[model samples]
Target: MEISSPPRSNATDLLVSTSSDISHLTELLTAAGLELGPGGTDAHRPPRRVLNTPRYAAMQARFDRFGSDGITMMCSTAGLQVCLDMGERDRVATRWAALHALGPVLLAVFANSARLGGRSTPWVSARTRAVLGTEPARTRRGAVSGDPAAEWAARVLDTPLICWRHGGPDWTAPPRVTFAEWIGGALPGVPTTEDMDYHLSTMFTPIRPRGYFEVRYLDSQPPQDWMAPVALLIALFEDERVVDEALAAAQPAVGRWLHAARVGTADPRVAGAARAVLDLGLRSLPRLGLPTDLHDEVTRSLDRRLAAVPAPHGGDLR
Candidate 1:
């Protein structure tokens, strides 16, 4: 289902609506000689195992230009699709900047991916680090501007174009060519505005812009514990006063995305801010009137994080 406006959208209602839909989907998949893989059930499974068909090969080939080399039949990574409702259009850019800033702490709090190539990986969220390790500029935290659309438009043009459609055997771009340069008659024919928009989608960042602010850093969690991060996100942003406190709490950890992904909560600064953010989310639970059971589950998830932080060489939480 689609949730265009989440604040204006009812969480309970959306859950009721989507639960049945998900169930139906599960049944259909089961009937189609397919089954749920050990993804959410197990953290060690490959996050993105895709079917290597020609279409997928082309897609992976494009990513290969960046730096990805894995072979599988279907893509499989799961994470909460979180969107914070910001009511006014006028302040979107400013609000987006604020949300974008909170990304590192969130990544630390929900750093769940501990596996790569079906075995334990060094990074707390190896999935995230691996993605960031790709074409550096495009994979890091995205840019923020006072005017989001305008800034995003500029970012799309300025970032290097990965590959474009053509009747050639190779889709690789010329060295040091950017979409902006292409627009100015650099190499291949100038692309349309729609093409530029498509290029923006290819770039990955913590915060992806939609009508509601989308946070993309949280890793795929255990199926039972997935809702906590989503709740944390909502509780932090649902009220203006809470938003201010959370932002201030996250100040020290700002721009520390790589650190957060690597160290998880063991990084002292991220741990402190994460504790504050988790505590703040707990405080807002009553006020927001979210489902008690789900919120309680979220509380348990946060409690585990506070009690144990991932160590660099050891997988044991302490």
Candidate 2:
């Protein structure tokens, strides 16, 4: 599933093809005790041990404390997670901010989960709703300003620890204990650099920038449509001018997370923003070096949605 150099001419096809191959292999294995598993955003089935790993067991125990919302996200939700390189050093902050700014537009366009527990829900993406309901200290995006790395560092230190991995199965940290507190000797043991690295891994912000940007806002699409969104993302960030255009197009809907997940494209501002970005992505496909057939595939898939968005309105999505 690794693309050594991403956005390669057939990168989207490569990813989708790889995913299908894995799914086929998984289907064969399901003849044993395993099942291919549920799709969409949420399935209301009660949590069970799918993997018997120690870290997973410990993390599940911690999530249980956050109530139904946290538990629901931990056990029931899945997404189409995209990881992109941070790009050049100088433009990294700009790219990071642009992605966050465009999040609502992209999310609105791709919102797929409309039901939970076998009943229809109001939200377009119930998966996002579940995440919003989870503990904000860990789940929400970090404030972006000044230095991207510094802001992220401060945010990480300020977040409450989910669990501290001890050799035993009970990797629970004391309630409400922040990592900064641990560093300042507020807890019994001295924390090390390794502990900090593990703590970084525990934070679940929407756009996590490790060595690369881990885009987590998009919902899981139906199998046939997954490639479209990936292609759109590749095109949107194809160059700096397009990135700026994207940011401007999405500005009206920026930070409107609740609106995006609820009504999605039904919200006029969100719809307009989505349309603008979709147009930009489609046009940029040629410059992206995608094959003519792939360009046509992405365009056809996205154009249907574009045709549905209303023209831009002055009202704020929020």
Candidate 3:
């Protein structure tokens, strides 16, 4: 997952595995002639693809109309997308909600990309801002419920498509024209099943659900450290005991998505919650039987970030 989407400096992004295999990933990138962008994911990256078809360029044009060239390029954000296994499809709904809320904690821990468009910014991950700010209805999540599929379907219908089908005099709809409205005869023609599927694909939320849950929000990191966040999240989700503890500790961060993007670990509460999650993640590593190198990377990352945080006036908490 390219945390740096529609990347600011380049026309391309690093295609990462949805799973965590740091060394295999390095080999793949090397083979593909791609190098991980230096340091921060969104900082100092050059200005930069989409579906093929006549609609592709039109889709890009609509994105360009909304914000920066980087955004249109869809290279402004990147993330870790860990997939939770689905047993007979209905099983993972609750976990989906858990991951949605826990997403911010991951962001707080791996908050890189302090600069975007080659300009310094206060935010740790400008990539997060670019993604959530893209189009509220689509980019930002709507309502999540116990029924993940139903909520997601409703959200897909509720969100206005970025551009209408190409045959119209103007491909853009009047502001807030939802796909449901188009299906209900508000648009001149009927919306096909294909149209519905394609529109859903454009809806980028902090977390998205397919057969597996897609955890989005952590910024793209350097190759050496990128695996830490992935390992941490996997440790939490794969182990049920850690999941409970992580969720309880991560609760305070549920709605701090925007704040996490802005102040990142600088926000004391975010740092505290992230540390708790990381600690829990560390505890699970040995039992999870993950490799030694991955264990070290996660430990080092958690220690470095938590150590950067100053001791409270009373005392050190961790």
Top model number, lDDT: 2
Q: Estimate each model's TM-score.
A: 0.79, 0.88, 0.78
Worst 10 residues of 1 by lDDT: 69-78
lDDT scores in order? 0.64, 0.77, 0.65
The lDDT of model 2 is: 0.77
Candidate 2 regions with alpha-carbon error over 4 angstroms? 1-13, 16-23, 26-39, 43-49, 52-54, 311-318
Q: Over the stretch 1-318, how does candidate 1's per-residue lDDT look in tens digits?
A: 122323446555554454555567668878988654433113444436345444344546555665542222124344456767764776566567667767878887787766655677677776667666656656667676667787766776777766665656556566557888987888857688777666676676667675556677777665446666776777777777777787787876777887887887777777777777777777876665657775566678777866664333433222
Model 3 per-residue lDDT tens digits across residues 1-318? 343222121101122332334556657788999666644444665545634444555556666657773352375445555555443445366566668767777776677777776788777777777777666666775465767778888888888776676564455555667889988887777888888777867777777766666666667677666656766666677756566677788886777887887877666666677767777777776664545655566678767876765343332212
